[model samples]
Target: MKNSDQTFSLQDISPKGLERSRKLTHLISSEIGATRQQVIPFDRFMSLALYADSLGYYVAGQEIFGAKGDFVTAPESGDLFGFCIAEQCAEILDENDVAITEFGAGTGALADTIIRYFDGKISVDNFNYSIIEPSPHLSQRQKIRLSKINSRLADKIKWYTTCPSEGFFGVAIANEVFDAMPAKRFTIQRGEIKELGVAYDGENFIWEIIECSVIPELIRDQMSNYPEGYTTEHVETQGIWFEQFKKFMKRGILLVADYGYVNQDFFHLDRCDGTLRCYFKHHLNDNPFFAVGLQDITTSVNFSYLAECALSAGFAVDGFTSQAKFLIGNKLGDHIATLSVGDSVDAYRVAQEAKRLILPSQMGESFKFMACSYRLEKNMSGFADNERFRLG
Candidate 1:
């Protein structure tokens, strides 16, 4: 195919982009010799997708929420989603003064709602707020929104460039964070599954499937689950993330909300093309090569692997459920009940979106909720009877 489009492609990299790509190319060629010219590992591709200096989609200053951004997350559903999460957080706080550390908090919408909810339920002195955001652009946006809140609550808010220090205790929450991690994609050629890698292709970056000799043996061993002829892919970064989570969390809850499925369901024979997707201006694009650094790239999470990693990291699997089940079980219905007393139109609109968030056909069933903890004896209140909860 002709690579003539200048809308957004490898050509858009400009002078600085070419220099960076040349440096990366030299680094790869030196490490792996000429074979590196044909294929670069999936992890490297992920780095480009997310953190390629200025061109990376997440690293760049692009709007990433609501109808205008690349994609919409549950938090974009508005205060209803935030209120539901705050309700659960309040229960966890109980009598202790705890800090709420949110990962990849986009636009601080959720944080704003959380602060409001906590303010209404308890004294502001009882809470401390912190957000871990990597993008300088997004962090500035968060500061702008957060400044509108009372200075007392706003002052309590802090930002971290990386994860918090080890042995931290409190609630660690992430909304749609795990899905953004770089995932390794694989395809079955002949009878052997090979990883897809990126290369310079002399003119521009291109993908090539090659043997995965560099991946850790433990991760490579998991490929045994695939059928003899079936091709599969895995998120190699998920394991690394769990280890990081274990190191930071000494005793507290780790709540992750994202779109994913169990291993069996995720790698079924029907899913040949894999879960890789690109989003630009609210439109889903399958070709990751098209947008380069201007679009959002994501894949579904593997809950089974996450559960196993958490267990190995000494975390007790408190609960595994859908976002819908967790929200309803935690009393989203109760929140809805209160909506009728106010502006009925706005309340109804919020209620409708809330339903879409939790319904199986929409995001509810597709999105999952997984929680793990250390030193906590009781089960997570929000996920109780999670398996039995039906999608509405």
Candidate 2:
């Protein structure tokens, strides 16, 4: 997956890709047709569209990262992002026997960057990298990419289809991961909360407002505050995910980096349509039903809700801040300085990447960094003087 300099539109999809999408559509249509109510919850639909067996988007053996793919992640932009994260890990794992467990290791770019950055900083015997990736297609890509690194670094890398059953100490990184989790879409209709579901209309998938029989406790109180037809998302599975994470993390930190906002900004009154978005090629759209399993569907995270889940799961809310501040706090400037003394062309490239990472109009302010710890007392370096746990 090479870096993409040009913007990609939906027109780039090939005939083969369309056929794969059609197969996935048929599979989803069949499942919805068999449902008693002729509709499935929005989260269920999203899960099927993105994670249903071999036909799902992530498992369909298609490149989904970098310029030629749907969208580019921060790590894909450059290595500075990974370098900063590696610095944070180094701070927390100081002289300790710990492994870095990364979730949804896309293309293994970040893993490769972090592992290589740790070459002289941490001893190989004290450091290991474990990837918990579910998509076999992506797993293959990661394996191929990481194998090119030094044999010693490659030997320290491990792969898992699920979280490890045994407990270990270290850091857990989830970069742009939680946003892909299936989220329940809800809207207020006739003064009551109703769930938006997906229904097959014989030709295309359509929206069906089903009665929300049991309101989620997290949003029950705010249900009445929204105006009529106000739509938003709620993720109840975060607590369950934390439960699983806690099992393997005997004493460590879970670092989450993604685009999100605090509760007040997340469910703001003016923002009615919610944060659900779909990416086809590089073009963005509000409709998730457009490409079926061929596109990426995601929703912005609610950090406040995530904090509630962490507290319930016995984890301490250690720190929270924007990605820009976190990176700056973690010595992004030092990297830029070092690179500036290198080849002139390389310095110019690093400058462009740094702007994209720290500029407010780019991913800087939009993305957030959150740290949740379990039985660990040390504060992470990325949040030094920039910690905003109160906002979380």
- The C-alpha lDDT values of all candidates are 0.72, 0.86
List of clashing residue pairs for candidate 1: none
lDDT of 1 by residue, 361-386 (tens): 99888988887778865556678866
Q: List the residue pairs that clash in candidate 2.
A: none
TM-score on alpha carbons, each prediction: 0.86, 0.95
Cα deviation of 238 in candidate 2 (Å)? 0.9
Query: How big is the RMSD of model 1?
Result: 4.5
Candidate 2 local lDDT, 1-392, one digit each (tens) = 12223255446678888788889889988988898888989999899889989888888988789777889999898889999999898888865575799999999999998988887665678878899999999999999999998847668888999898988788899999999999999888888888888999988899898754567876776667678988899988988998888888899998999999888888888778888888877877788887688889999999999988888899988889999999999999998887678788989999999999999999999999999999997767788855564464
The best candidate in terms of TM-score: 2
- Which 10 consecutive positions of candidate 1 have the poorest summed lDDT? 1-10
TM-score of 1: 0.86
Q: What is the lDDT of residue 208 in candidate 1?
A: 74
- Segments in model 1 whose C-alpha atoms lie over 4 Å from true places: 1-35, 202-204, 212-231, 388-392
Clashes found in each candidate (C-alpha, N, C closer than 3 A): 0, 0
